[model samples]
Target: MGEFLRMRRSQLQLADVGLRDFGERRRVPGLRRDELAQLAGVGLSYYTRLEQGLSLNASAEVLDALARALDLDEVERAHLHDLARASRRTGTRRRPAPERAGETTKQLLAAFGDAPAIVLGRRSDVLAWTRTGHALFAGHLDPHIPDQPDQRPNTARLVFLDAHTRDLYVEDWPKKARDVVGKLRLAAGQHPDDPRLAALIGELTMKSPEFASMWSEHRVRKWDLATYRMHHPVVGRMQLNLQTLNVPQEEGQRIVVVTAEAGTGSAAALRLLAQAGTSSGAGSARQAARTARRP
Candidate 1:
C-alpha cells in the first residue's frame, strides 16, 4: 500500500495539481510527501506513517480525502480500497492459485466457430483458443502455445515481449499495454497470495523496463468491451470489437470474443482468417477436444 501511494504521488506534477513551481530546483519527481499530505487535509505525521506502512487503520473518509487529492479515477479508487483491506490483514495465510477455466467455458469457445474466441485464466494465461482464434491473434508465434498448461503463452507476456504482437498493435501498442497492466492490477488486488501471479509480475518487472514503468503508474481498469485496431500480417489493417464474458462457474476466468462489424471490410478480413483456419486440418479439432478435457 505504501509503495503504491508513493508511486501514485510520483506520477503527479505541480501543474497537474494546480500548484505553482517557484522555479526552485526539486530532487523528487511529482509532488513531495508533505505537499500531498497538505493537499489531502491530513496531518503530516499521519500521512507519513500511512506511506511508511506503520499505520494501517485509516478510515474511509481519510482514504477518500487522499484519493481526491491524488485525482484517482473510479477504478483506481476501488483498487485503493482493496489495497487498504489487504494491508489490514498483513499476516493472513496465503491462498492457492485461482481455478482454471472450466470445461463449460472451453465448450463455449468451441461453439463459436465463426468468431474468434479464447479463454483466459486469472493471470492472463491463454487457457484455450478456437481455430480462428489462434490464426487471428497468435498465428505468428508457436501454434501449440495453448496446448501446454504449464507453458501456455500468457497474454500479458506476449503483449510486452513478443515482436509479432508488437507489430500487430503498431501505433496503439501503449494503450494495449496499459490495459493489460491495469487489469493485472485488479487481479493482483483480488489474489494477493497467489505465487504464480507474484512470479509473473516479478518476471515482467525485471525483464521489461516498459512493463516496470507502467506498473509504477498504479492505474487500474475493469474491462467489459473494448475496440481495438490491428494490423494483421495477412489481413491488413482492420478493427475489431472485443467482448469479454465471465465464466460464472470459474473464478477469475473470462472468455473473450473478437468480432467485426457486419458488412464491413473488417468483417471480410475476419472471414478470410476463418477460412484460412479451415485448412489447419483435423489437428485443430483434436486440439480443441484436448483443451475441453481440462477442467
Candidate 2:
C-alpha cells in the first residue's frame, strides 16, 4: 500500500504534518521519512524502501503497526486495508453475508419490553423491533407505516428534522440532535460508499440547518449512555435511562434499551405502556414480514 501510494509521485512534499514534535527549526515539509519509520518501529531503510516503492509486500501486521503509529481509527484502518488490497492487484470480492441477528437477541428484545427495545441497522434503519420500542423510539402514529421503507421513522431524520421529535423532548433537543448527527457522522466515515447512508445524509443536509451545522463539526461518535425526559402517549411524562448494547455477531447492529428505576410510577408506567400496543403490533409485524417474503 505504501509503495503504490508513493508511486503516485505527488508534487507536494510532506515532511511537516507528522513530525515527532513539530519539527522544531526543521527545513522540510512534513515528518522526514526516517522519523515516520522510527515512530512506526520499522527500520529506516526498510521504511524508505516502502515509501520509495521498492517494496510493496508488507504484511497486514506491518500495515497495522504503521496505522497505530499514525493514530488511524476504525475507518482509517479499513481504508488502509482497501489500499493494501488495491495495491496487491487483488480483487476483493467479499463473501455473501451469512450474518444476521440470532434468535437469542430477538428473544432478549422481546423480554425487554419493560420500556422499549429497538434494533437499528448499520445505517440506523429500523430493522426488527419490539412493540413498545416502536412507540418509544418513534411515536406510534401508525403501526402499518414500517411496511414501507419511506414510512419508517429513521432515528437520524427524526432527531434532526422531525417537528414531532423536536417538540416531544422536554429538554436538550440540541444535545440530542448533536448526538444523532455525531453517530451518523461516525457511520458515514465507517461506511463512506453506502448509497442508502449517503442518500440519508444528503437528505438531511438539504432539509435541516441543525443537522447541516452539526455534521460540519466532524465529530463522529456513538451513543453509549443517554438519559432524557419524554412525553409518552400510553403513559404520560416520564424519565428513562437509555442504554445501548451492540448486538454480538451482528456487525453494525445495536439493541437500544430504555429503562426506569424499579418501584417507581415511571417503571409501572413504562411496563404498562410497553404492553399497550404490543399484541396488535406483533400481528401487524408478522403480516408485514410474510408479505415481504412473498413473490
Candidate 3:
C-alpha cells in the first residue's frame, strides 16, 4: 500500500491538483507528504506514517479522501482498496494454482470463424487461439509456443520480448506496452502469491527498461474494448478493434477478438489474410494444434 501510494503521489504535479507554487526549491516529484496530507484532510504525521508503512487500518472515509486527493480513477481506486485490505492480512499469501481454458472456451474460440480470437489464461498465457487468431497475431513466431503448457506464449511476454510483436504494433507500441503493464498490475494485485506472474514481472523489469519504468508508475487498467493501429508485415497497415470478454466460469481467463469496420481497408486486409490461411490449410480449427514456422 505504501509503495503504491508513493508512486501515485509522484505521478501528480502541483499544478495538476490546482495548487499554487511559491517558487520554492523542492526535492521530490509531485506532491510532498505535507501537501498530500493537506489535500486529503489528514495530519502530516499521520500521512507520513501511512506512506512509510508504519500505519495500516485506514478507514473507508480516509481511503476515499486519499483516493479523491490522488485523483484515482475507478480501477485505481479499486486497486488502492485491494492493497489496503491485503496489508491488514496476517497469514502468508498462498501461491496461485495454474489456470487453463476448458473445453467450452476452446469451443467459443472455434465458433468465431473469421474473427481473430484467442483464449488468454491467467498471467496472459495463450491458452488457445482460433485459426485466424494464430495467423493474424502470432504467425510470425514459432507457432508451437501456444500448444504446450510449459512453453505457452504469454501475451505480456511477447509484448515486451518479441521483436516481431513490437514491430507489428510499431506506431502505438508504447500504448500497447502500457496497457499490458496496467493489466499485469491488476493481475498482480489479484494474485499476489503467483510465483510465475512474479517471475514474469521480474524478468521483464530486468530485460526491458521501458517495462521497468512503466511498472514503477503503478498504473492499473481493465482490459475491455480497445482499438489499435497495427502494421502487419503481411497485411500492411490497418486499424482493428479489440474486445476482451471474461470467461465467467473460469477465473482469470478472457477471450480477445479483433475486428475491423466492415467496409474499411482493414476489413479487406483481414479477409485476404483469412483467405490465404484457408488456401494454405492453416485456417482449419484442427490445424491450430499443428505448429508451422512462419513463412
- List TM-score per model, in order: 0.85, 0.61, 0.90
Error of 3 at 89 (Å): 2.5
Candidates in order have lDDT scores of: 0.84, 0.66, 0.84
Among these predictions, the greatest TM-score belongs to: 3
lDDT of 3 by residue, 1-295 (tens): 8999998899889999999999999899888988989999999999889888889889878988999999999899888888887777787667777777788888888889978999997799998887678877888755566778888988888999999899989998999999999999988887777889989999999999999999998999897998999987666778999999999889889999999999997887676667536445544322432222224
Pairs in clash, predicted candidate 2: 14-30, 15-29, 15-30, 15-31, 16-29, 16-30, 16-31
- Compare candidates 1 and 2 on lDDT and give the better one: 1
lDDT of 1 by residue, 131-238 (tens): 788887898656667777777988899899998898888878898899999999998987787888999999999999999999988788889898889987666677
Q: Output the lDDT of residue 85, model 1.
A: 85
Position 292, candidate 1: lDDT: 38
Residue 201's C-alpha lDDT in candidate 1? 99
User: What are the RMSDs of all candidates, in order?
Assistant: 6.8, 10.4, 4.9
Clash number for each model: 0, 7, 0
lDDT of 2 at 107: 86
